[model samples]
Target: MSEHKDLNKLSAAGLLISLGIVYGDIGTSPLYTLRAIFNTVSEGGQTINPMMVLGALSCIIWTLTLQTTIKYVVITLRADNKGEGGIFSLYSLVRKKAKWLVIPAVIGGCAMLADGIITPSITVTTAIEGLQVKFTHMRVIPIVLLIITLLFVIQQFGTSLVGKLFGPIMLLWFATLGILGMAYVVQDLSILKALNPYYAAHLIITNPMALVILGGVFLCTTGAEALYSDLGHCGRNNIRVSWVFVKATLILNYLGQGVWLLQHPHYDLRLNPFFQIVPEPYLLFMVALSTIAAIIASQAMISGSFTLISEAVRLNLWPKVRINYPSNERGQIYVPSINWLLCAGCLLIVLIFKRSVNMEGAYGLAINMTFLATTILVAAYMISKKVPRYAIIIFVAVYGAIEFTFLVGNMTKFFHGGFVTVMIGAVLFSVMWGWYVARRIKSRFVKYVEVEDYFEIISELSEDESVAKYSSQLVYMTNANFKTEIESKIIYSILQKEPKRADIYWLVHVDVVDEPFTQDYKVTFLIPGKLVRIDFKLGFRVEQRVNLLYRKVIEELVKNGEVDIISKYTSLHKHKIAGDFRFILLEKHLSKFSKLSVYERSVMWWYYFVLKKLSLSEEKSFGLDSSYVEIEKVPLIFVSAEDIILNRLPA
Candidate 1:
């Protein structure tokens, strides 16, 4: 296998295009961040102090610079898995040494998923909200709904078509920010003084409502997780290079909003302050263009969510669902279940809130929790990896302090709106964690027999004239492990029913790794008797083509002197020495004996039933030829007291 590549290999031009597509979320925040901040302070047309607005704008600029730029781009991007970075990437890096931190990592990942839902809702809603400045009577909800519906509808087509336009459109979006902001900045150069950190410090320490303000301000950095998660897609250098332009444009636009606010203290630009800076005649066209831009931003997050969930499923951190790689491009995939789930959630959020401002109250919790979780994981990574102690201490202190403060600020909004986000995330995380635990328990109880024992049985059976005449080799495809319940069933079924065996016994186990590319076969020979066992670790990102791999494995075994190279395992062989394949499928049916709580049993049953319908067809999942493949279903019973209660409980 080739060594993993890094960001340095990409050309400068490729990096720029990658950045525009990957960093679109953080890049697009200027469209709504300033408007969100001012809306919080200027409730009901209340005249806000010019100094306060400047102070808030100053805080927004410095926060992006310090929290997003320095913290994420400079420090966080350095913590990557091969070249991938995300909550799971960081989790994989630190989980071995800092196992205790997995809880927080899981929580962070759950919150990031929640953020995925709310992002598109708020982004599209805010863009549509800008319509009021020009149309004055345009229906906002319908437009927002239409934009979101179209965003998801296009996801099935993959990103290649829209991806090319993402760079140039976002480039134009950032340029608009600069041009509009400069127009306002020239009117009052005094707004530049707010750039000093002291003003933000003063506002926080002196103002009683600073906590709420900070909570609102936290929305400005909501896309920081997107910056890290998309690292694999865009590469680290592309994101870093792109952020230079993205961040500068964001800061200038924010300062320009401050300049505009300072001049028009009584003006209620409740819809969107960013668009207010533009000339009135062009504001409608800007809204139309921005709605398109916002939809693109939302699309990027939706795509990123698909990739994250795909990785989660591969790592066994999340349950298996249907995953389709719509593009030959390395990381492009579409998960129908997740895509629809997010669309439904975003639609509900938009309908319930009816405005981006209401959704804003709920947005920061997921982002803050995700950031805090990442910091804790990063600190653990530093210590375990034997990085300099002083560096760990200093970095942790800086990041932890900011993270804690933001967590508290975000928590303040919990009952008001943040609770909704947390609840949704909790539901998802619980399902994933529950499934993981159940799988582990099932694995633990499985009976394990030595390969020597099975090989000895095969050796004895090979000598029997009746057994040897049936088939040349026995190939059992099983979902369970080599020594688990399925193995026993395979043995019993062969002896009691057919009463025949084959010349060779092949034990194969296939594991899906969370990489973009992987080899087809990894062979192991159990010694003394040289019992052949092989593991085929395939990449989840690759198509599951069993026949192709089987051919390669047969070739490899022949070269290794394990099998004859010339004998094809075709069904039409004249000597009737065709390879007999038995697929042992272990199906778990929940019963009163299963050891689950009443609630847990209900959840499991619900999952089981839903999965029965939604899961990929068994024939496809196994990559088997239906014409020749023989399948046997073996039922495994795992009973606990909870199952009894669930069965006895009234429906």
Candidate 2:
């Protein structure tokens, strides 16, 4: 079994890596968060009230403190699954406690994936919007689109080289944020009064647009979920320690922006406060640096999307998709289908929204669902750990109200592009929900029989001379968990289909465990040399390359003198040639003769015809060679049609 490295140990490199990977999204939030907040309240170039400024600033401070720092960085990080910390990873830990928990896991997974589309579009566009400060007439759309196209294009070649510079670039970016923010904060130390919670409460009670302001405020902590998702890449302690530095700079920058706002209460809403604070001499350089930072943030989100979908596929929450390892780096992966799809979605968002300000609503709405979902899973996790009842209730009550309020605020943008993200999340959720439920519906009818019932017959079939040899060793992939049992379809394929004869029969089962990197296999020799069953227990994050893994198991078995692979033929055996192995895959299809309710039929239609068509084929998904694999179509009759009347006409 492969062991996970201890990236959690506190060290300089670990902190640097955490800066690059864990903070990309939140680190870049300063790009547009305050801009969106002021724009919401200012309305039609009106003078912005001083209370709005101080209250909004106070809201931003505590939101980051409670939402990002306390809930995620401090508490949720404790729910790590063997050093992994995503909604799915958290769900995997508590799924057995309650089957209903899958609802939140799937919802959270789809919402985060949907967030990937807008994060790139908004961050890059907002950063490039800085160009307008120097060149008022510059067309930002074309430039933003070009940058995004280039970013997605490089995904296939791997980013290890470019990835190495991410830590340093982000480090510089955060430093720039702090410097520019401090330059303004010193001019008006009184703006620091916004840090008081009283201002936040005053705004909520008196401001009519409180919900709208909150929708904007939610953007600051959007990356908190991503912070937790990347837990495995950089351990918990690294994140915790780096977050202190990250949060300090973020607060300083936001405070600086507040001071700038206080100095000019009626400042032009067209200009972003984030860029306005920058000294004119460095505006262009700042714009260029921010664009690069935006790309890094986008890349991290895209890569995280691939990892999320990969885990979903292994856990059977999603249909199998082709996953490619473009680099030798341990966790780096590329999914061509998802990569291109995300690219197209991003381009579409740029074309429709046309400005970073227009995307704020969509971005906030999409990620708010993810925040709520994570809260649910984390609460369930605390419950599983047997935390005190009062603590659990307080945790849920406080964060639940916080996130739900954010959701309501985001909902205000439904007609104004929020629906864009909602619709995307819905489509993604349907696919995941359909895939999971359809599997349950199908599994309910799958037949399993005791393997012991057929051991004697399988042994005899291997020795039957009248039957033609299928292969020296014939293997069948089974879904049965216990070594004492096998899927009935596999038995039907072997004995009833063609009466296949072979020197040996092998049944292989794959069990995806909750751990992230487990890779252990158990081999049970039912009839030593004649019949065998191998169970491969893999972690959710582990790739299921059955062909390669099966071969490795055979090699180990042969080395231990538990099996013989030499050709059984008289001539080939003398030459010591290797035996041939063939794999049988029984593909299932919906049977027309089966009776199904309208809901089941719809789910089956989507799962089989839609999701199944979109997914990789069984042979390719399992990493099996086409030449050595055979697929037999099997009709899946969940409920057979009522006894047909006069079906036989005396034939």
Best by lDDT: 2
- Residue pairs with colliding backbones in model 1 are 593-639, 593-640, 594-639, 594-640, 595-639, 595-640
How many residue pairs clash in each candidate at the backbone level? 6, 0
Q: Candidate 1, residues 195-289: lDDT per residue as tens digits?
A: 88878888888766677778878888888887788776677777887788777877788888788777777775564677778898888777877
Q: Tell me how far candidate 1 lies from the true structure as C-alpha RMSD in angstroms.
A: 5.1
What Cα-based lDDT does every candidate model obtain? 0.72, 0.90
TM-score for each model: 0.88, 0.97
Worst 10 residues of 2 by lDDT: 1-10
* 609-635: candidate 2 lDDT, tens digit per residue: 799999999899889998999899888
Model 2: lDDT of residue 578: 89
How far residue 83's Cα lies from its native spot in candidate 1, in Å, is: 1.4
Model 1: residues with Cα > 4 Å off, grouped in runs: 1-7, 44-47, 463-473, 477-500, 512-516, 525-531, 539-548, 555-561, 565-580, 589-651
